[model samples]
Target: MPEYPTALGASSRDSITLLGKDLATDVMGEVGFGELAFWLATQRRPTPGETRVFEAVLAALADHGFTPTAIVTRLTYLSAPDSVQGALAAGLLGGGSRFLGVTEDCGRFLHEVLVEREPPAGDDGWDELALEVVTAERAAGRFIPGLGHHVHKDGDPRTPRLFQIAREEGLVGPHLSLFAAIGRVHPRVLGKTLPLNGAGVCGAALADLGLPLELLRGFALLARTAGLIGQLAEELRHPVGNDIFLSVDLNNRSVPPSAQGGPHG
Candidate 1:
């Protein structure tokens, strides 16, 4: 028999047993989620605040009505009653890319305002900045990331609440003030309100928290997992999850073969 490396081998066995117990108990308190994830997978702990960052990020991304992702959750529940996890996984597969980089972008925007010490005079200054940014981005042929929303013609309901929370929690500082500036600016520019949507607020919050840009999307996913789970549970109680989304597919997909004269099946 070949000799096993007792030193490292013993440590590996210890890690496995510890992780197994931790998993069974859901004992995430002592070790942060980021550290726990890393330790279980690679026997290394996450640095610091990685877990808190993970938590805030997850909470922020938890739900936003029935986007494609939420729709998939409902559909999977309708099709497979017992497979809640499966439904959630399916929904997550469709989670939008828009949510991923939100925190980073918000942070950058706030950072710009902070570094520049440029405080807008009420809403008008805000509008001018928005116009300048929009015009520049459009002229440059780049898509504007967050401005107007589809469902929220005037403003997003989610953004203001988040800002309020940030202010109450004393988390709002430089970035938050900038977000306030953005909110005030919305009504002046497009002659319509542009309440800070979830993505934009999340951006500011993440920046304030000092989390890196790369983690925002992952945070969104973790946050949304809660929504997926809730949606799955809700879907279980009634047949309400039964709405055919073929139309959604139709709208999102490529134009159908030059509108070929008739409804060819």
Candidate 2:
């Protein structure tokens, strides 16, 4: 016989233990889902400040108003009302580069840059470093993760609020400092100012909180899970999926198969 060692959760005939505490008594009503999530990821309890910041990240990502993820979720549900999990999974699967994956991309990008150098002494130093980074990225023709927002061209509302919250909590680490500096200095290199989008800011904040860089997107998905459920709830009440499908189905024009190749071909 072989045994697997574990510290997360265990059940014995009459009792359940999680993170070495009574699951029913210590974890049920006493622990919040946000704090628990952080704890589960780090295997250590988070401070009140950490919990606040982490929960804010979750809230920031929870919904974005008819994003493709929400649309796919609703459409999937309409196609198969019997599989709620399928609908949710469909939405989560859509979390890639242009959507929730920005959280992870921004965090990892910032971390990679920070690890290559020492921490800056102040905003001026950070700004200088940011400028050099932006210039190099521009020269390389690479997009800066978390640089812009399609909807909030002027600014991302969530970006500043999260920065304020992190500042108040004294949890603004190097990742966020660098991200803010980038916001200030990128315009000089790119020749245009772009809002630091919410997903990108969430990535910076999560990195500052010392969350795993790889799992950053997982957190985004976690937040969007709530949004997908809300989308489904609204879908049940308002029922727009069929209309959306019909709109495209009815409006699309059919052309010869040769057109698929290209106009010149």
Candidate 3:
């Protein structure tokens, strides 16, 4: 017989247990989902500040209009209207290095910076360390993750607001500070206006919140799931995926119908 490793579990027939606690009596209504998420991930309850930071990060990344994930979700639904779970899974499947996966990349980068830096001596020390990290990354031909965006050219509007909330909660730390310092030196180092992006801030903030680097990106996945659900709901009402397909077909009408594929059933 094979043994299964498990920490999170549930027992059927009467009541359920999660993290060794009674689910219905100890958790179901007593704590908010954000707090529950923390407990589930860490196997311990979060402090008030930790909960606030976790929830804020989740809320901040929850959605962005017409993102690829949302588009894929809608298209999947068009192909199979009856499977809501399938549509949501299709959207989530788009998460990777180019998209939501960048959360993990950014988090790991910041973690590396923190690991390499000496204990802070003064304000100048942090700036010097941040500059060094940026310079090395640039020299290696690494396009720094979480620093630039295709849209929001001037700057990511979410960055400042997230920092502000972190400040209020006293959750700001070396990772967040170093990320911002790097942004200050960005124009000088890169000779371009690569502003700090939301994912960068999220990575830094989650680092400061003491989340493991491996789990940092999971927070983003969870947030985007909620956003995809909302998008799927709206998609059902407005129904644009078929129209988009038609538009593409109409524009490419010059191609021989034979090359487009056989007739659909």
CA-only RMSD, every prediction: 7.3, 1.4, 4.5
In model 3, which regions exceed 4 Å deviation? 1-6, 253-265
lDDT of each prediction vs. the true structure? Answer: 0.61, 0.96, 0.85
Measured against the true structure, the TM-scores of the candidates, in listed sequence, are 0.62, 0.97, 0.90
**Model 2 whole-model lDDT (C-alpha atoms):** 0.96
Task: Estimate, for each residue in 91-195, the C-alpha lDDT of model 2 and write its tens digit.
Answer: 999999999999999999999999979999999999999999999999999999999999999999999999999999999999999999999999888889999
Please state the error at residue 99 of candidate 2 in Å: 0.3
Which pairs clash inside model 1?
58-223, 103-203
Least lDDT summed over 10 consecutive residues: which range in candidate 3?
Answer: 252-261
Candidate 1: C-alpha lDDT = 0.61
Q: What is the lDDT of residue 258 in candidate 2?
A: 85
lDDT of 2 at 260: 55
After superposition, the stretches of candidate 1 with alpha carbons farther than 4 Å from their true spots are 1-60, 80-85, 98-135, 138-144, 186-191, 242-265
> Over the stretch 127-153, how does candidate 3's per-residue lDDT look in tens digits?
788788888998999988898988989
lDDT of 1 by residue, 6-105 (tens): 2112234434335444433444456666556434434445445434443444566788776778777888877886887788889877755465455556
Model 2 worst lDDT window (10 residues): 255-264
For residue 48, give model 2's deviation from the true position in Å.
0.3
